[model samples]
Each structure stands twice: as C-alpha cells, then as structure tokens.
Target: MRFLLFILICAGLILTAESCKKECHDRSNPDCENYDPCYGKQPLTADFETFEVSIFPDNWIPYSTDTLASSDVFFRAKEENVEYEWTVGSETITTRSFTRKNFPVGVRIPITLKVKRKTDFGCFPTDSVVAQTRNIFVIDGYENSKVAGYYQGYHTNNAADTFTVCIYIPEYSMNPPHEKTTISGLMNISTCADNKINVSGSESVGYKQYTFLSQDGFCHGAWGRVRVDSAFMGHIRIDYSYLKDLTDIKSQVDKTFLGKRIN
Candidate 1:
C-alpha cells in the first residue's frame, strides 16, 4: 500500500508541473495569470497636442522692414514622468511643453514626439513610444494684406464669364511715402502699373480700403476693398474706371472676387 501511495504522489506532482509549464509558456494568453500578456510590447504611451497662433492680427499691416512674419506653434504632451524629445524639421527639443516661435507659413509640417520610461522588465530595459502630429500649416501674415494674391470671381452683369485678377502691393508702412501697388486682370480690366495707393480703414469696417490711380500716364483709378476671412479665404472688390485706349472714353468695373492665399 505504501509503494502504491508513493507512485500516485509522483504522478500528481508530474501532472501539476506539466500544467504550470503549459500555462507559463503561453505568455500571450490573457487567461494565464502567471505570465504577462504585454511582454515584449511597447509599454509606454506618448501623445501630444498643438495649437497655432498668427503673429499678425486682423488689423495688422505688414511692413517691408517688419521682421516678424511667421506664426507660433505651441506643443504640449499628454503624459508625464517620461523623457521627452520633440523633432521639428531639422531641430530637436527636450522638454515637456514648449512654444515654437516664428514657425514657417504655407506648408505642412510633421512634428514627432518620442518618450521613454524606465522599465522593470530587464529584457526590455526601457519602454519607449513614438507619436506623430502632422498637417500643421501656419498662415502667413501677409495673407491678410490687400493686393497680395490672385483672385477670381464674376461680375454681376456676366455670371457665365470668370474674371481673374492679380494684385501686388509692396509690403506696406503706416507712415507715408509708401511703395507702389499694381493690379492686373482679365475681362475689360487692363494692367494698371505704378499705382500710388493709400490703404485706409477702421477696425469697425473690418476691411482694408485702397484708393489708387495709375501713374503711367493712363486714367486708371479704383476704390477697392480687401478682406481676409477667418478661414483664410481672401475677398476683394474693386470699382475701377479707366480711359479706354481704343475709344478714349472712360470704362468702369464693379465686381467682387474670392480667392485663396498663395503666400
């Protein structure tokens, strides 16, 4: 009876050892209590948020000598207690939160956030995570300026015909002796070069006013208004009158244009 009892006890010990071996070896199984399911996986989480602020406000006038033209992007990490490294373009920053001043405009930017934490798992040693944020576009301050971009729209008289216009205003100064602004367009409007334009408006009106005349010995004059909406959509309206070279008579144009900012 004693020998039989010893044989049974040895069989029970072997069965218990086999069960434990099966459970522990299946480390990926969630039901296995003795083994970690997250073994060999990245154990750290990394995430971040970004906010952009335009350096120039609605009433801001851009001067040629004015230095600040780019926007600012603020970055913040959602997690704490881990080492942080931020990669922006060719530069790198090591901080929990930071503000990037004078960020470039009119292009998509990819910002990367990397974090690492000390781990108890010797095989892994350190838990590392990488997160990426992209499609960051900083609006150019010059976008808000009048006579700065290509515009397209239709006149009320002829909706079927598209009128495209381009305006170029040299970087402006609030003080006098400003550089010349120019306008060129299709559909009855001739290129008016060397326009001596003075832009004036109040904040309550929410638009820049440009009353200009051609200095190139032609009777080209206009009262124009330009507004940049919140979505960066540019709007322009010109009441133009010029002496036609063919008829030697004055012609007029009253139209509004909508366009996107290229700069």
Candidate 2:
C-alpha cells in the first residue's frame, strides 16, 4: 500500500507542471479550454513604438480624436495592417490619419490612441495610442493685420448675431520689430476694432466690410467665423496654445464673412 501511494503522488506532480505551460495542441494555446484573453500577454511595444511620458496627456477623458495622416502640418505614422482606435474629445474613430478638412479649423483639441493587440489566443486587447501631432490648422497670413484687426458690428448675413472686433498693430515678429503679430484677443463692449496687431494659432477671426490688408486682400469680410451662424460678437473664443507661428501663408482663402461695421 505504501508503494501504491507513492505512484499516486508522482502522477499528481506531473499534472501540476503541465498546467503551468502552453501546448501547441490547443487552437487557442490556452493551458485550459476557453481560458480568457491576457492569461499571459506578450510585452506590448515590442511590435510598436515605445511610450514617452512627455508625448501623451495625463488625463484621458474629453480627448480630441484624430489619426496619423501626412500633410504640411501633420506627421503621419507609417504603420499599417495593425488595428487601432482613436478617441478625440468624447468621439472614437478607426483610422490612422487626418486632414485639415476633418476638423473645425483653428481649434485645439485633446486626443487619445488605442492600439488593437493580441492579448490571448484568438483575442485582442486595445492598447493606448503611441504618437502625437499638432491639433490646429495653419494658414498663411492667418495672423495678419486685416483678419486680426478690430471691428464693431453683427454678421450682416445673420441679423441676430453681433460682433465687435479689435486688431492691434502688426507685432514685430522679430525682436527689432519685423511687423509681425501673435494670436490672442479678448471681448469688450466698447469701440476698439481698428488696430493692426497680428496674432498666431487661429485664423477664424476676421473682418470683411473694410477690405483689411491682413486678410491678404481676400475679403473674408468682417465675420468672426466663416460660417454665418457661427460664433458672434464677443462670443468667439480661442485656445491660446493652438495658434501657429509661421512667416509665410499670406493669401486669400475660399471662405467669406459679411457683417455690419462697428461704430
């Protein structure tokens, strides 16, 4: 009977060792049947880019969604055939690239990326995205004296909307004063919409009635927003950081805004 007990003990030891490893026999390669995903996972980032703390934001929610695309202002990641999900400011998409046409121009938005990866046999787990890029559109003369100048009135196209614009003299893009500008502004109830200051980051601000030169002479008109029903009067707001500062882009764009002149 002692010998019989010894044989049973050896059998139990063999079974325990087998459970600890994977076998090529199962389709899912799980130690047990129907085992869940991530029972054991290959280290992520091996087949993808390494994580950099400085590139991603600390808080994830209200993230602005975007993708890896190639353009003058955007840097596109070259990875393909790999699954990924992008979450931008409460929305999710499944692409790896985007263009200026994809989002509202000149707005700064937060973004997030999730890579689809195999965490178990026949299963994939979504991993955090691993890249970053600019979140606002850039244009020539975007911060020019015309569009950035001040005005007082309502969008002529829409009677209900009122506006008061103020543009300071074109700032010195250079230390010695190259007559450049920056992108920043505030709302007021008084008259101060006639300065020639240039600002950066956004081109959404404008005045069309007076043919401002900062507009690159294109008559985008005196519309705070390109859309007639867009932000009105002191209602236009900007994300100060989203402004871009390039020394070129001084040309006419396709959009136009019509509004009354402020007193």
Candidate 3:
C-alpha cells in the first residue's frame, strides 16, 4: 500500500509541473509566445479634453496683431466637482479653464492638464489621469497672407484697360507668397509694356481709408491696405497724374502707377 501511494504522488507532481511550465518560461526566449505580462493589469490612457475658446482668431485680422483676442481652454471629467490644474510654460493655475490674449504671434505654447478628486465630492486622495494640453499659435504673417483671386480695378468708366487691375496669387506649393500694398509694387516693373510704359517711370501706389469707400465689407489684397473713396465704393479709384503708357495687350493693362495707402 505504501509503494502504490508513492507512485500516485509522483504522477500528481508531474502534472503540476507541466501546468506551470508556460508561466515559468524564459521571457527572453523568442519561442515563448504563451506568456503575457499584461494579462491581469489594468490600462491607463492619457487624453486631452476639447473646449471652446471665445478668443481664438478663426479668420484673418485686417489690422495689427496687438489687438486683444481671448479664448478659453479647459478639461472636464464625468465625476461631480472634480478639480483640475492647468499648466502652461512655468505657470500653473487651479482652474477648469484659462483665457489669454496678446500672445506674441508665431510663438507656440504647450499646455498640460492634471485632474484630481474635489474635496466637496466623496473621493480619495488619489491622482487621476493627466492629459496633454493643446498647442497654440498667435495670429501672424499678414504680410504673406493668403489673398489669391482675380479682380477688376476701375478708376475710370471710359476704358477698362486704362485702370484695370489684375490680381494673381502664385501657387503656394511652388513659390512663396508676395507682399505689397501698391499697384506697382505688386507687378514686375523691370520690363516695359509694348513701349507704351516706361517701367522706370510708372506712378506709385497710394493708401486711403477703407471707411471712405462706404462699403459694407473690407478687402486687403496683396496690394496691401486698399483705400477706396466714397465715390468708388465697389471699386478702387486712383487719380493718375500721368498715363503709364505701359500697354500689355496680352494682359489688357494700360498704365503703371505708384500709389500710397491713405490710412
């Protein structure tokens, strides 16, 4: 009876050893695919909460970047009365949202969000998931702004070519955008137009007040800030002291002139 009991015990031990072989396999072994380190571990993921900001510049500004622009960004949780700490640069504020304005244009800032259970709510002193904050940028690059399209500038009713202004924005992929606030500045003044214009002797561009145009909307073309008089509300008028004589039948341009912004 003793011998039989010993054999039975040995058989039980063999079965137990076989069951633990998978768990005890070498972690470095390439063939050990049965081992899973995260089988019983819970997962933690970081997230960023999207909040609406009242001060973000969604459209292009017609003037300076110093103008006040405010927006709010914050994080929220499903728990009631949850507390949050917002961090940006070296500053940390204990609020659910933050508002900022006058940030330097072209500067990118990173923000972080840390959350904890509020004392008012029944919660433990444990830290919750901290999410990464969104990066921000100020309104910049008005000089190289995107103002691409065709326009007809008529300063006179007799002839369209006499005061016709053709605006063309280059392909953004091949060439960088150009900036100018004047008719001559936006054109290639190096070459003359069919001997009609002296490239070196064209008129200059002038700036005027947009309000004087008495128009409802505003347009800031590559020619810079446009100045439209009340009489030319729908169009731009320039009083050229002399004809540009720069004739381009291909483009239907008559004269080239220098101009200044009235504002």
Model 1 stretches astray by more than 4 angstroms:
1-43, 53-70, 120-127, 141-263
lDDT, candidate 1, equals 0.54
Q: Per-residue error at 37 for model 1, in Å?
A: 13
Candidate ordering by lDDT (highest first): 1, 3, 2
Looking at model 1, residue 247 earns an lDDT score of 49
Question: What does candidate 1's lDDT look like per residue over 1-263, in tens digits?
Answer: 99999999999999998888676755666766556755766546666766433332442332211122245656777778888988888989989888788667666777788887776475564555556554565545443444466777666556677756666666547788755555556234333333333322321111233344455444343444444453343555555444444344445544555544444
Residue 47 lDDT (model 1): 69
Clashes of each: 0, 41, 22
Cand. 2 TM to true fold: 0.23
Q: Which regions of candidate 2 are displaced past 4 Å?
A: 14-29, 35-71, 81-137, 140-177, 180-263
Between candidates 1 and 2, which one is better according to TM-score?
1
Each model's TM-score? Answer: 0.33, 0.23, 0.28
For each candidate, the alpha-carbon lDDT, in order, equals 0.54, 0.35, 0.36
Cα lDDT tens digits for candidate 3, 163-210: 334322222243444322223323333332321211111112111221
